[model samples]
Target: MQRDYNLIDSNRQQQQSKRGEFLASAAAAIAAAAVAAAATAAVAAAAVAAAAAVAVAQQQQQQQQQQQQHQQQQHQQQQQQQHQQQQHQQQQQQQQQQQQQQQQQQQHQQQQQQHQQQQHQQQQQQQHQQQQQAAAAAATAATAAATPATAAAAAAATAAATAAAAAAAAPVNKASI
Candidate 1:
């Protein structure tokens, strides 16, 4: 009986030792799984942070592009305004030059008209003087050739012919006889 009790006690001690070894292996597996989960969470957080940084960089680039476009548009508008102003000024200057030329042309035409009038008046006065001298010579010739009563009639007839000749030869004027 003592031998059997000793064998049973030895078997019970071996089983308890096997159960303690299995429990220790299970605790190590749980600890390893918790470490893996922690590492995965850290990786996910890092990925989210990187994505946020990339988004911010893209937004900044878009804003810079927009600003540059706005500045270029403003510059173009200002240049167009300056160009329009220059064209307007050139047109005004051309108009002024044309007006001045027209005025000068009018003055030149007036001067030419005045010169022609002066020449015409001088020619008329010379013709009048020549007619007067010819009439006086005819009257003297008639007085030498005729008796006193006939000489007066001849002088009167010669004067009438001279007036008719002058009227036919000269241009009509406001002051002409």
Candidate 2:
């Protein structure tokens, strides 16, 4: 009876030792799995941060490009407006010059007309003076021819002198002569 009791006690001790070793191994495996999960989560977070930074950089680049395009468009519009204004000014200048030329031409024509009128008036005056001189000469010749032959020669001479004085007073124009 003493030997059987010793063998049973030894078997119980061996089973308890084996159970403790299995539990220790299970705890070690759980710890390793937890560490690996934490490492994977950290890597995922870093990747997300990198993607967000890339998206922000792209947006900034696009905004800058848009701003540059807008500025270029404004510059082009200003140039076009200035070009239009210059064209308008040039057209106005051309019109003004044309008007001035027309006015000058009109004035020149008026002056020419006035000169012609003055020449016509001078010609008429010269013709009138010639007619008066011719009439006076005719009157003097008639008196000399119609006088009586028996009359005194002095009386005839006096009549001729009076006629000459009348002709001298009536002075013919050089143009008519």
Candidate 3:
């Protein structure tokens, strides 16, 4: 009976040793699983931070492009306004030149008309002087032709019809006396 009790006690000690070895291996596997989980979490956090940085860079690039487009549009508007102003100034200058030319032409025509009138007046004065001289000559000729002769000698000639008239007059001979 004592030998059977000793054998039972040895079996119990062996079972306890096997249980301690299995518990120790289980604890080691649990620790390895915890370390792997921690590594994976760190990798996920780094990926999230990189994504945020990329988003910020894209937003900044978009803002710069919008500002450039606005500035270009403003510059184009200013150029257009300046071109319009230059065109207006050129038109005004052309109009002024045209007006000046018209005025000069009108003045030239007026001067020509005045010169023609003066020539006509001079011609009329010359004709009037010639007519006056001709009238004076005609008056002088009429005064000379109006002189009268005496008729008293004719009355005596009636009595000379008789034969006594031959002795009263001495006539000039055809030949020399």
Q: What is the lDDT, from 0 to 100, of the residue 167 in candidate 1? A: 76
Most lDDT-accurate candidate: 1
In model 1, which regions exceed 4 Å deviation?
1-25, 140-151, 154-171, 175-177
Candidate 3 Cα RMSD (Å): 20.4
Q: How accurate is candidate 2 locally (lDDT)?
A: 0.78
TM-score of each: 0.68, 0.69, 0.57
23-87 per-residue lDDT for model 1 (tens digits): 89988999999999999999999999999999999999999999999999999999999999999
Worst 10 residues of 1 by lDDT: 168-177
Poorly placed runs, candidate 2 (over 4 Å): 1-22, 148-177
TM-score of 3: 0.57
Per-residue lDDT value at 53 in model 3: 90
Clashes, model 3? 0
The TM-score leader among the candidates is: 2
* lDDT of candidate model 3 versus the reference: 0.67
* lDDT per residue (tens digit) for residues 57-119 in model 2: 999999999999999999999999999999999999999999999999999999999999788
